[model samples]
Target: MTIRTAVMAALLGAALTGSAVAQSGGDVGGVWQTQAGDANVRVSKCGTQLCGVIVSLRDKIDPRTGQPAIDDKNPDPKLATRSMIGVHLFFGMKPTGANTWSGQIYNADDGKYYASNVALMGPGTLKVEGCVGALCGGENWSRVSR
Candidate 1:
């Protein structure tokens, strides 16, 4: 093949490879349902990082009071009265590797922040892990359609 043809072929191959890499990395922006099926979080880009907000909850009422749930567990008294819905629980997640991100996650249940990592296991599956001190736990979340 002529030199020109060879260079063109190489460029085209590089472009295809780049596209595949991007697709394999996956997009984290979407709605994901927690493993317990208790909540659905909407993940989206916040500046250059990713953030997730509670969009829906299986139980909206506080069992003890029969009123809408609040972030009463939050350590900060000023924030404790805020509604749980629309609360940003995942923050500043930066891409760490292909299909994976690292950041911090706030556990409203216990009112604590933990080092967190998330990975897209598949087109519809996500693995989320949170570590506090030395102990760590994780759960698999599924993509929510609409």
Candidate 2:
């Protein structure tokens, strides 16, 4: 290709890459809003490990009881009364890479614990995965406010 054509192609490539990078953030820490927009979670350092906590909910009150929503699905009876807000989604997650961690995560939807991994895909994206035996599934969370 001619030099002028090559330069145009390179600029186009750079522009596309820049756009993707703009959409993807570079840092992991921040409050992230889930895909469903039902809740906001703050992932931060809890001592030596990173932990995620439910900070806000779209529906904070339980419709059935007209009170605050709770972790009714928790395995431990003692924890069942705890509110959904401030509940730990994943704790004891040890860093496995510069922006990844491996640990167990609580699934309120199923009220069970599963092997889980958290990775920073980009500044604006976080990849969270949970596994039951060999089956694994995950969703991407987006940064709301840094």
Candidate 3:
């Protein structure tokens, strides 16, 4: 093949690969949870952007007290709400740059929405942050072992 043709082909291939990598988002697809709070979340793509949702509930057990974690905020007085499962407890995310995404975050505890951002910390970890107006908080999620 001509040198020009070969160069063009190589450039085209590189562009395609870059685009795919950007869309796939390195390693953001998986289950993630926090160490300190109840932020167990699963990351997935909503349309073209990455998003997270609560899919499982950690068994109700307190680490320090070895007692069952009780849901003190449950609206129903008698119903046990310590662990919530299968809630669409997050919002969609869009790519902002390399390994960074901006989106909306939903708090399952209170059903509130806020500004959200996420970044891949490692191969199986994602650092997720959410902001309430101006103040922000974040959590580190380890990839769930499936």
Please write out the lDDT profile of model 3 over residues 1-146, one tens digit for every residue: 99999999999988666546667767677777776646467777676688666665576565765775544445555634444554554566777656777888766555566799888877877787889878889877788743
lDDT of residue 124 for candidate 3: 74
lDDT of 1 by residue, 1-146 (tens): 99999999999988666545534567777999999999999987665567889998999998998999999999999999999999998877876656677889999999999999988888788899999877889999999963
Q: Against the hidden reference, what TM-scores do the models get?
A: 0.80, 0.77, 0.63
* Higher-ranked by lDDT: 2 or 3: 2
Global Cα lDDT for candidate 2: 0.83
Give a tens-digit lDDT track for model 2, residues 30-63. 8999888888999886654678999999998989
Best by lDDT: 1
- Local distance difference test values of all predictions, in order: 0.85, 0.83, 0.69
Ranking under lDDT, best-scoring first?
1, 2, 3
Candidate with the greatest TM-score versus the true structure: 1
Model 2 worst lDDT run, 10 consecutive residues = 18-27
